[model samples]
Target: MDFFTAQEQARRQTGRLVVLLVLAVLALIAVTTLVVAVVLYMAGIGGAHSQPQPTLQGMMALLSWELLASVAVGVVALVGLGGLFKRRQLRRGGKAVAEALGGREINLNTRDSDERRILNVVEEMAIASGTPVPSVYVLEEEGINAFAAGYQPGDAVIGMTRGAIRQLSRDELQGVVAHEFSHILHGDMRLNIRLVSLLHGILLIGLAGGMLLRSLRFRRMGGNKRDNSAALVMGLGAALMLIGYAGTFFGNLMKSAVSRQREYLADAAAVQYTRNPQGIGGALVKIGANAKGSALAAPQTAEFSHLLFSQGIKQGFSRFMATHPPLKTRIQRVMPGWDGQFVALKPAPGVTVEPDQSPQSTAGAGGRASVRDNVRASLENAGAPHAGSMATVLSAASVQMAIGAMGQPDQRHVAQAQTVLSALPAALKTAAHEPYTARALIYAMLLSENDAQRQHQLAVLENIALPDVFTELHTLMADVARLDVQLRLPLIELTLPALTSLTIEQAQHFRLCMERLIHSDGHVSLFEWTLYQLLLSHLSEHHGGAENLTLQACERECQRLLSVLAAAGLEQGLESVQERASEMAHALHAAQQVLPFELAAVEDADDMQALSLAVERLRRLKPLQKSLLLQSMARCIEHDGRIRPAEAELFRAIADMLGCPVPPLLGGGTEEQAVLAE
Candidate 1:
C-alpha cells in the first residue's frame, strides 16, 4: 500500500461516511414524522375519533403537513447538533480520545519493566516506520487490547491495556504495537473518530426518549394520571423511546460493518509489517485461552469498542453487530491452512513465551536481528561529511529516495534508524527523557552562536525558566551547541513525547519562550524560524492548522511552494545563478510529470516571505499532494548535484510541517555517498 494512496482512500471513506450519514438522517426524519403524527392524533389535536375509526390509509392521509415539517426539522436539528457538538469536543484529537477512555500516559522515564519494554517496541516501530514516536498511554483495564488514535501523525497516541503489557511476550507485544501502527499508517484513526461521534449523535435520540419516558412515569406516580393530556404525554414518550432504539439498531449495523472490515486489514498489515505471523498469531491464541478474553470493563468501552484491538464487549447473538471478526477467521487470514483448533496458552508464573528462534537475530538473516547487534551495526553505518568538502547537491533519484522513505521505511531505513538512535550524545538523550530537561534542551538548541545574540536568547529564557530549567540549560548547552547539524532535528523529534507531557499552561508558556528567543536576535535565521514554527505547531494542544486545506482549492499555494523551493536551489547552488535557474526549471518540469503543477516566475526566487506563506498553505494539502510536494522540493534542491545540511534541514522541516516525519537523510551519509546509498 502506497502511503499517499492510502491517505486518499481514507479521505474518500470520509465522503462515503457523509453519504451514509445523510441516509441515516433521512431515515430518522421519516420515523419521527410518523411518530409525531401519531402523537398528535392521540393528543386530540387532530379531529377526535369518537364516532368512527380511521383506516390505515386514513391515518396516513391525516398526517398534517405542518406537523410533519416541524418534526422533520426538529429531528434534523437534533441529530446535526449532537454530531457537531461531539466532533467539537473531539477537536483536540488523539489526546481527547485517550482521556475519554481513562488512559494514563506512561512517562518516558518509567521504571516499570513492562511499560519500558512497550515504549521500546513503540519507539523502534516508530523509527522503522518513519513517523515521529507517538505518546504512549496505558488503560488500567486488564483486557488485552490496544489502539492507535489521532487525526494526524503529530498528535497521535498509542493506548494499551495493562493486560497486553503484562501478558504478552516482547515479540507478541511488538506484533500488537505493529498492528496499531498500521492503523496509524493506513489512515483509519480519523475515520474511526468520525464513526464514534456520528454513532453517539444517533444514540442520543434513544437516550433522550428514555429520559422522557422516565419523567412521564414519575409524573404519573406523583399526581396527574387519568386525564387525556397525561395519557397523551405517556403515549408520546413511549413512542419516542421505541423510535429512538430503532435508530440505534440501524446505527450499530453501520458501525459494525465498517469496523469489522478494517480489523481484518489491520491484522493482515500487522503480519506483513513484522513479517512474523506467529507473533500476532500467538497474541490471538493467548486472548482466546485467557480468562480476561480481551473484553474491556471500562464504562466507555462500548462507545470505543470499534477502536480496540479485539472485541471490547460481548459479540451478542447477532454477528452483524460485532465490532471485530471472530478470532478463528482472523487467525486463518494471517496463517493459512490452520486446523480449526485453538490452543489456549498457559505460561508458568512470571514467564512469557519466547520464540524458538528470533528472526531478527541471526547472522546472514534478512529479517530482525538481536537488538544490541542492530544498534551496534547502525552506529557503525552512521556517516559524516568529510571536512572542507563543499559538495552540497544530490541527484534527482537520491531526492526521490529520501522523500519515498518518509513514513514508509524499509529494512535499510530501519537499520539506519538504529544508527540514528545510537548516534545521539548521551547527555542529550538523558535530557530528552524528562519534561523539564527536555524544555531546557530545546532552549539550548535554539540559543544563538554569537555571544550578544546568545545573551539575548538567555534573557528571554530567564523570565519563564524554572530554576531547575536554567541549571539544566547551563549543563547541556555546550554539548548541544557542538552537536552535528544533522542530529539537531532528530533530537527534537526524540523529545516530542516528553515535551507533550507538559500541562497545557506550561506548553503555552514554553511556546512563548521559544517565540521570544527566535525574535530576540531581531532576525529569524532560517533554522531558528523552522525549529520554532515546527515546535509550536506540534506542541500547541489546540493547533488545527491543516484542518481546512484541500489540494483542489490550494493550487496557487502549491505553485508558490515549488517556486520558493526552485528559487532556493537557484540561489544556493555553486554554479552561475542563471545556470542554476535553468537546472531548477528542469526540476520543476519533472515535478509537473508527477503532479499537475507549474512554476509561475523566477522573480520570486529569493522570496523568503513567500517561502513561509507557502509552508503554511501547503500544510493543509492532503497526504498524496504532500508526497508530490516533498518530491518536488527534493528535485529542486538536488538539481545542483549537492545538498547542503541547511537545505536538507529545510526540506525535512517542510515535510514535518505537513505531518510527514522524515528521518535524517540517508542516515547522515555524505552527499555523494548518501545518493549512492539510496
Candidate 2:
C-alpha cells in the first residue's frame, strides 16, 4: 500500500470512531431527555385542582437543552483525550525507536565480517532507497521470524529472530525483512502504534463508567437505602454507563478492523519491496507446515503481534479482534496456487548443498549488477552522492547469507553485544553509560530477541563474566528500561552474577535467581524472555540439559516479582542503584568525568559577541554541553514542542569534545520513501 492509501484508511477509521462517539452521545442525550420528560410530565400531576403552568414547561425545556449540550461536550472531551494520549504515546514510541537504532554504527569487534556485511548491506539499501539506514537487530530465537517497528522511516527498526538466522535461506530472510520494511516505508507501523495508544485511551472511558456505576451502587446501599429518588438516579446512572460501554465495544471492533487491513497491506508491500513473492511465500509455506509455526508462547507476543512478520498473537476471543488475516488468505495472496492443505515442498532431486558464495539479493549492489547501477543508469539518480550506500542498507537483508557470511552471534546477546561493540569505529566505541550508546545498542540487539530468551541471556552472562562487563552489560539493560515505560527486568535478573568468579553452585544459584525472578514477575517480557531462553539453550554446553525446569522455575519467579512490584514497598528504584554503582569508578568512568572537553574554533559561533567576548562565551560549559548534545540529537528538529537547531549544533560540538565521531546524514531514499524524493 502507498502513503495515500494509508492516509485514506487512517482517515476513514478515525472518522468512523468520531461518528460512533457522536451517535453514542446523541443516544445518551435522547435517553436522558426522555427520562426527564416522563418525570416532569408525572410531576405535573393531572388532578381536579391542577392548573397548567407555561413557565414550568419552559423551564423543563431549557433544562433538557442544557443536559444535551453538556453530554455533547463530555463526548467530545473523551475523544479529545484519546487523541491527546495517543499523540503522547506516538512521541514516546518514536523517541524509543530512534534511540534504539539511530546511534548504532558498525562495531568492528564482530568476530566475522557477517555483521559488518549486515551493516554494509543496511547502509547500501539506505543509500539506494534514499533513506537513512535503519537500525538492525539479531534475534536469538532459533525460529525464523523478522519484524519492522517504528512510527516512521526516520525511526524504524528491523529485527530478526535467532531462528531465522539458523533456519531461513538468505533469500527467504530477505523476503521477511522486505515485508517489514514495506510496513515501515508505507506508514503501517505508525498506524499500528497509534491503534494501540488510542485503544488504551478509549477503553479507559468504559472502565471509568463501570467504576462510577459500581460506586453509585455501593453509595445507595449505605444509609440512603430507602431514598427512592436517589435509588432511581443510581439506577439511571448504571444504565447510562452500560450504554456508554456498548459504544466502547463498537470502537474496539473498528480499531481491530483497521489493524487487520494494514496487515494485508504490509503483506502486499513486502512483496513489492522484495520484488520476489516466493522468497517470503516459500518461508510461509515452511512455517505453516512446521508445528511451532510463528506461535510465540511469550506473554509479550500479544502486545506486539500486529508488528510481527506473521501472527504470533491474539487480542480478544472474537475473529474481528484478530490483528492479522488468516494464514490461508496470506499464503494465497503471496502464492496463488498454495492450497490450504499442507504439502511439504520437496527439494529438487540430486541437489547438492554447497557453500553460499553468490549473492541472492542486494539488488545487484556488491554483485554483478547492483541496485546502484540498475537505478543510476535509469533516470532516477538525482545527484545524491550517498544514494548508493543507502540503497545497500535497504537491499542488505534481501541478500543471501553464505557460509562465510554467517558467524553466528552468541545466544547470550550481552556477550554478543560485547562482540558487536568491539567492531565499532574507534571514535564511536564509548564505554557504556546509563543514558548513552550502550542502552541503544542493547535495545537494537534485544529487539531481535523475545522476553524469556532475553532473561536467560542476562542470566547466562551473570553467571559467566557479568560482573566483569558492568559498563556495557548494565548500560545495555538501562536502555531497555528507558525504552520501556516499565522497570528494567534485566536489572532484577542482574542481582545474581557472582563478582568473584563462577562456581558450580554459583551457576545453580543463578538458575534459581532466574526462576525466582520470573515467578515473581509473573508474565515475562515476551522479547526479553525469548532472549534469556535462547541463552539457556546456548548455555546447555556449560550447564546440563537445555530444558529441564530452569525456564519453568523462572516463570514461577516472574509471578512473584509481579506481585511484589504490585505491593510497591519491597521494590528498589534507581537511587539505590546509583549509590551502589559509585564504586564502579574504572578507567572509562574516570575518563568520562575528568576529560577536558575539546572544542573547534568556529569562525562565526557568536553573532552577539565581539571577538574577545565570543572567545569567553565559547569557554562556558553549557555551550560545550549543548554542542555535545547535537551529535546524538535525532532527526526531529522539534522535540517536546520546542525548536533545538542551536542545541543540535552544540550536541555535535560536545560529542566531538568527547572524541565521538558523527555520521553524515543519509537523506531521501528513492523507490521506497517519497518524502526522500522531495
Among these predictions, the greatest TM-score belongs to 1
**How many Å off is the CA of 650 in candidate 1?**
3.1
User: TM-score per candidate, in order?
Assistant: 0.87, 0.44
The 10-residue segment with the lowest total lDDT in model 2:
402-411
List candidate 1 stretches off by more than 4 Å. 50-54, 221-226, 337-341, 346-399, 402-408, 541-556, 563-597, 600-609, 641-646, 661-678
For each candidate, how many residue pairs have backbone atoms clashing (under 3 Å)? 10, 108
Candidate 2 local lDDT, 144-227, one digit each (tens): 466666654444556665455445555565566656655654556666666555555455555555665677655535564334
How much is 412 displaced in model 2, in angstroms? 34
Backbone clash tally for model 1? 10
Predicted structure 1, TM vs. truth: 0.87
What lDDT does candidate 2 reach at residue 612? Answer: 25
Candidate 1 Cα RMSD (Å):
4.8
Among all candidates shown, the one with the greatest lDDT? 1
